[model samples]
Structure formats: C-alpha cells, structure tokens
Target: MPSLVDYIIYTFIKIDDSLNKILEEYDRPLRARVFKPKLSDSEVITMELIGELFGIDSTVGIWRYFNKHWT
Candidate 1:
C-alpha cells in the first residue's frame, strides 16, 4: 500500500488536474491583473487544501507550514 503522504500527493494531483481542466473550459480571466504571478492557481489551491487538512487557521500559519515542509 502507498504511504499516507503518497496518497495525499496523489489526491492533490487529481484535484489540480481537474481544476485545470475546468479552468481551461471557462472564458473568464484567471488573473485579476496583467502581470503574471510566480505561483500557479493550482499551486495556491493545493496550499490552501494543505492548510485546511492540517487545521491551520491563519494565512501566516499556512505560509509558515508550507515554507517549513515545502521549502
């Protein structure tokens, strides 16, 4: 069996793929400004999901957790 981390990663990948597909089918502008962001929408969403899964309440806590584990 795959480890818990592996399962989490797999689920995240599936969710991201689905999100991308939906976005592609839409006509709405994804970004608010002309300038592009460093991180993709899917990446930001994955981080948000991680924050929720880990019970992080604040944006700062989410950043800290992501930086600690991802960076």
Candidate 2:
C-alpha cells in the first residue's frame, strides 16, 4: 500500500495535473492560521470547489465566500 503522502500526491495529480503545475505558486505565499487552528487541505479544497463552481476566480473572493458560508 502507498504511504499517506504517496496517496495524497497521486490523487491530487490524477485529479488535476494543472494543480501540480501550480503547486510551486504557493510555496512563497503567506500562510496564516484560522479557526483557532489550521484547516486541512480538504477544507481548503472544499472552498476551492465551491468557488470554482460559482465561477469565482480570485483567491480573496473564494476566501470571502468560505468565510460567509462556512462560518
């Protein structure tokens, strides 16, 4: 069986190869904590999904939607 990282990497790449192309984009971005703790990738991905589905393009817009609906 694959390790957690292996599975996560495989699943992510399989789901969207463009995601891999964009992975380097976040390495230098500011990562702030929220909700008294850090949210997992699943939570972030959920917000991304909703945002993309609604044709939201900006990161700030996605965050605003998540804050409004997920609160």
Each candidate structure's TM-score, on Cα atoms with residue i matched to residue i, is 0.75, 0.45
What's the lDDT for all of these models? 0.81, 0.64
Question: Which tens-of-lDDT digit does each residue in 17-39 have in candidate 2?
Answer: 55445666786533455544466
Looking at candidate 1, the ten consecutive residues that score lowest on lDDT are 3-12
Model 2 ranges off by over 4 Å = 1-37
* RMSD each, Å: 2.0, 9.0
Residue lDDT tens for model 1, 1-71:
99867866886798789888888887985778778898877777777787877899888899898889778
Best by TM-score: 1
Strongest candidate by lDDT:
1
Candidate 2, pairs of clashing residues:
none
User: Per-residue lDDT for 23 in model 2?
Assistant: 64
